[model samples]
Target: MSDVRVHNFSISLDGFATGAGQAPDAPFGHAGERLHEWMFATRFWHEMGGGRGGSGGTDNAFAAMHGPGVGAEIMGAGKFGPPGWQDDPAYKGAWGADPPFHTPVFVLTHRPRPSIEMEGGTTFHFLDASPAEALKRAREAAGGQDVRLGGGPSVIRDFLAEGLVDHMHVVQVPIVLGRGVRLWDGLESLEETYDIEAVSAPSGVTHLTFTAKSR
Candidate 1:
């Protein structure tokens, strides 16, 4: 069976994955780009944007694992757009026309809409299903490859609670957001089931990997 994995998911020192007041302009909210500054400095990010010349260090090494062997992605509606995006019939997604996920992306939402096919082989499919049901659909869409769990924190938490994730890579940024959506709210003793490892990068962020022991 293909593994369900998460990569490059960022959180603050206080465990907040996203800040408050999420608008179209403020995607990450008050946290701004602090959580992803390390990623932006990576060579992988630069190359993804059709550019070059970025840090090719440990941070880059971790960021580079985001793609490859992932046939499909399952992201929460929050990751798709800001609040109230469902009311906008014209809203496509936060990513412009050409999204980075070059696979079938299933978005978890209560209001399902028609799938939107964009450039770079990225197609957005909205689903109103539980985490297990959504994963089933995503895995089938993934063909024989692994399924990437794209998240906005809450969705990741739900999947984690259900023991649906096989691999998870979390980046703990050095900042502290006192108020925001947290990742480790209800999850306790998560380290018991997964073999956890943490590596501190030169950019001051700690890369944490959680691989299921059964795997």
Candidate 2:
């Protein structure tokens, strides 16, 4: 069976994944790009830009795992764009023409839209289904490979709450957003479900992994 996983999902020291007031100008809101500074310094990030010059250490190794073995992705509407993105008929998504996800990307929204074929292998498919239903569709699209849970906090939390995620990697950036969408909200004693591992990197970020225990 293909596993459902999350990789390089950054959260603040306060457990917030994104700041409040996400608008067209401020995607990360008051938090800005602070939460993802560690990833931005990694070679994996630069290489995605079709360039060189990025660090190659623990952070890079972790960032590198974001792509491989992922045949399809399921993300929230918020991660697809800012507020009112569906309103705009011409919205191309947050990553523009060529998104990093070179697979079938399923966006979970109340209002489903037409599929979008980008420059890369990414083809956006909008759906208004529950976590299990969406995961089923994505797994079929994955063609026997793993399905990635591309999140924006709330989405991740929902899947986690439903016990749909098999593996998860969270990068804890050293910052306190105080207010915003939190990852750990309503998830108490999560260590019981998954064996958690913590590795602190040189960039002041802590890499956390949660692998579900065998049933």
Decoy 1 TM-score against native: 0.99
lDDT of 2 by residue, 77-175 (tens): 999999999999879899878999999999999989889999989999999999999999999999999999999898999999999999999999999
Model 1: lowest-lDDT 10 consecutive positions: 20-29
Against the reference, the lDDT scores of all candidates come to 0.95, 0.94
lDDT of 1 by residue, 15-134 (tens): 999998889899899999999999999999999999999999999998999998999999999999989999999899999899999999999999999999999999999999999999
Tell me how far candidate 2 lies from the true structure as C-alpha RMSD in angstroms.
Answer: 0.8
Quote model 2's TM-score: 0.98
Residue pairs with colliding backbones in model 2 are: none
